[model samples]
Target: MISACGRDNVGSKNTAQASHSSADAATRTIQTVKGKVQIPAHPKRILTDYYAGELLSVGGHVIGAAPLEFTNPFLKDKLKGAVDVGDPINVEKALALKPDLIVTDSDKNYDQLCKIAPTLYIPYGTAHNIDETVHLFSRIVGQTKPGERLLAEYREKAAAGRKALKGVVAPGATAGLYEITDKGDLWVFGPNWGRGGQAIYNALKFKLPPKLAASNKQYLQLSLEALPQYAADYMFLTSYDPEHKGTALKNLRQSPVWKDLPAVKEHRVFYNDFNTFYPYDPISITKQIDLFVDMLKQNAKENKPGQGQGR
Candidate 1:
């Protein structure tokens, strides 16, 4: 009996060793924005400190995320059980989750997250366009095929939007977007920002005036008095604080400078929800395109003689 027990114990030890070897062999080294990391063949539990939308777009199995509330509303219902790891990321909570891989923005806590798990640093605004950002994240998580499909779908939607808007928007027409903060500061969004700039200026092929076209910055602070100089044939206005009761919009509508602008006189200024238009990811861009096309069609019917004719 003693000899038989010893042989059984030896066999169990060899089996354990073989299982560990298999696990080690399943991992492969992949280069990240920060450096190379050995990740599992399929990362089942992923912790994305930022760009949760982009990760989900490529079908990443995200277990935890940061800035959880900022995820696009369309995907919010899908992330019902995702843990909120805090904006800068709560390392202790992240460690408790025991994720197979962690993806974070290039924030100050990059090194700290690396200590907790196999982390990859992908900074926000690093990619120039949504497709580039999606592709990069997909490659990191070994979902390149899904990423390509997502990109193709996005392109199809954009092309359809352009076709729909062509008949509604007049030739040589321009569009502008601005947001008023709760503190009453005015800001403008460009092609790089999350405020529908990519969909409006790039995908939909809208024109930007010479003054607003001079810079490549994502956002620019503006004064209310100078609103006329940057006015376009159509304008989108929304408040930074969604629950503010439209105080800023009210003030702008009452102002002589704002009332005199062509878009305002023509009733071409459209109001949008802060949450819907704030994210510039693939999902959000798709929604923004839909909203833009719908609004343009409605506004075109309201266009009157001598409306949107001013400089």
Candidate 2:
């Protein structure tokens, strides 16, 4: 009887070891500073901290998304069915969902998030750089594709958009972008400041002010009274609020120097949908390029009748 009891205990121990080994083999685990994160063979519930809209467009269904003070029309219209988990700092709400995987903007909250579920920290890049943002999201959502086919296809689309834009942006035309603030201070864009400006410049190939090439990599700052310095052949203005329309346009028009600038003189200041003006991925950029090209075409048409005709 004593021998039989010892054999049973050994057999039970062997069975436990074998079960653990099989489980380890079946799961895919990634090591990070937070520890090991195991990826389930099939993940069903997904929660995203940012870029929830991008994930949905790429065929992933998210159960929860970070809350916003105001809904993004682009996201609100499409994700009517998704639940808002309040915000990035809303731990209680996020915990209630019991997600299978959590996707965040970076390694922030790594320790806490890893404890909740296997988390993938995607780098969205800084305001000046979006290469990391585009690439990371592409991989997570499977935009890279089999044999890099999807990437090739997306590249083709971007190339085509650039080609189409070449015919429209007039020779010698210069442009500037502005971000309006509540204090009425205009944060002029530069090559290294915002993703919107960088992507726009990449697509339109517009002539940039010499100041953009300086060490600052940012354009000159000015009071509303000094708006003339920013006026050029073409100007794109962006604001977070609809109310800024009257104020932004009025400020530029009333300034004596601003009113005399070539772009302002020609009424070339175009307001953009504050949200669509920026992009997170190539597809978003392509859409904005199409809008810019159309604007340039219209400007050319309106100016054609007076060209070389004299006033």
Per lDDT, the best of the predicted structures is 1
Give stretches of model 2 more than 4 Å off: 1-43, 57-59, 67-78, 106-111, 120-132, 141-143, 146-154, 171-173, 191-195, 216-231, 242-249, 305-311
Tens digits of lDDT, candidate 2, 1-311:
11111111121110001111245554344332233345443456778776675555455567788664125544666566667875563556667887776767655565566667667654443323334344444444433442144345445655676677565666555777776654466757764444256555754567665444443556556676556655556777766565555665556447676556666556576766666764444345435556676776676666564352101
Number of clashes in every candidate structure?
Answer: 0, 0
TM-score per prediction, in order, is 0.84, 0.69
1-311 per-residue lDDT for model 1 (tens digits): 11111111121110011011243776655554444455665678888766677777787887787764455686687577888888788878888988887877655676666666666666667677877777667765666787788788878888998889777887778888888887788888887787788888878889875578876566778898987877788888778865666677678668898888877778788877777888877767766888888878866766667654221
For each candidate in turn, give its C-alpha RMSD to the true structure in angstroms: 10.1, 10.5
C-alpha lDDT values of all predictions: 0.72, 0.55
lDDT of 1: 0.72
Candidate 2 lDDT score at position 249:
50
